[model samples]
Target: MRIHLDTGRSGEKLAAEWLSQRGYTILACNWKYGRKEIDIIASLDNILHFIEVKTRRGHGFGMPEEQVTRKKLKNIKTAAEAYLETFPQWRRVQFDIVSIIYAPGGHNIQLLEDIS
Candidate 1:
């Protein structure tokens, strides 16, 4: 469990940095509403993004993005709604996923935008 948590945290950090390099301004990390959590909240080009970060050591089971099921998306949506209630200034919103596959030598990252 600790290893899983560590990997997830590392992945989120990488994702945040990657987004920053691409001109995304990060607003929050590990933002939660109830039991649901949005891994990262960022804005780019006037669009607010609620992002999910999925990290894995390898693809033994499958790609990291494949783990994001419909139920998970629903939960993210619910959390995003709660977030918007607090910060209603964001009229344009998008859902995204940052998938990371970490290895000893390197890591592969992919960003899936507008997932919702």
Candidate 2:
């Protein structure tokens, strides 16, 4: 449990920096609506990106990207809708997944964009 928590935090930080490097402006991290959470919210090219970051130490269970199931997407979409109600100035909203896998050597990160 501790390992998972640590990896989640680390992955989020890394993802935020990666987004900045890509010229994305991060608006929020860990944005929540009710019981659900959107890992990151960023914008670039007039598109508001709702990102979900999944981090794992290995593929023993599965790849991180595989963790974003239909239920998760539904929750994220709901959360995004709720967010827009408060901040209604968004355009071209998109969904993305940042999958991080950390290993003995280093780490691997993949950004799968516009999954929604």
Q: Cα deviation of 113 in candidate 2 (Å)?
A: 0.9
Which ten residues in a row are the worst by lDDT in model 2? 83-92
lDDT over C-alpha atoms for residue 4 of model 1: 88
Each model's C-alpha lDDT? 0.95, 0.94
Deviation of model 1 at 54, angstroms: 0.5
User: Would you estimate the TM-scores of all the predictions?
Assistant: 0.96, 0.95
Q: What residue pairs are clashing in model 1?
A: none
RMSD of each: 0.9, 0.9
lDDT tens digits, residue span 1-116, model 1 = 99989999999999999999999999999998989999999999999999999999998879999999999999999999999999999999999999999888999999998987
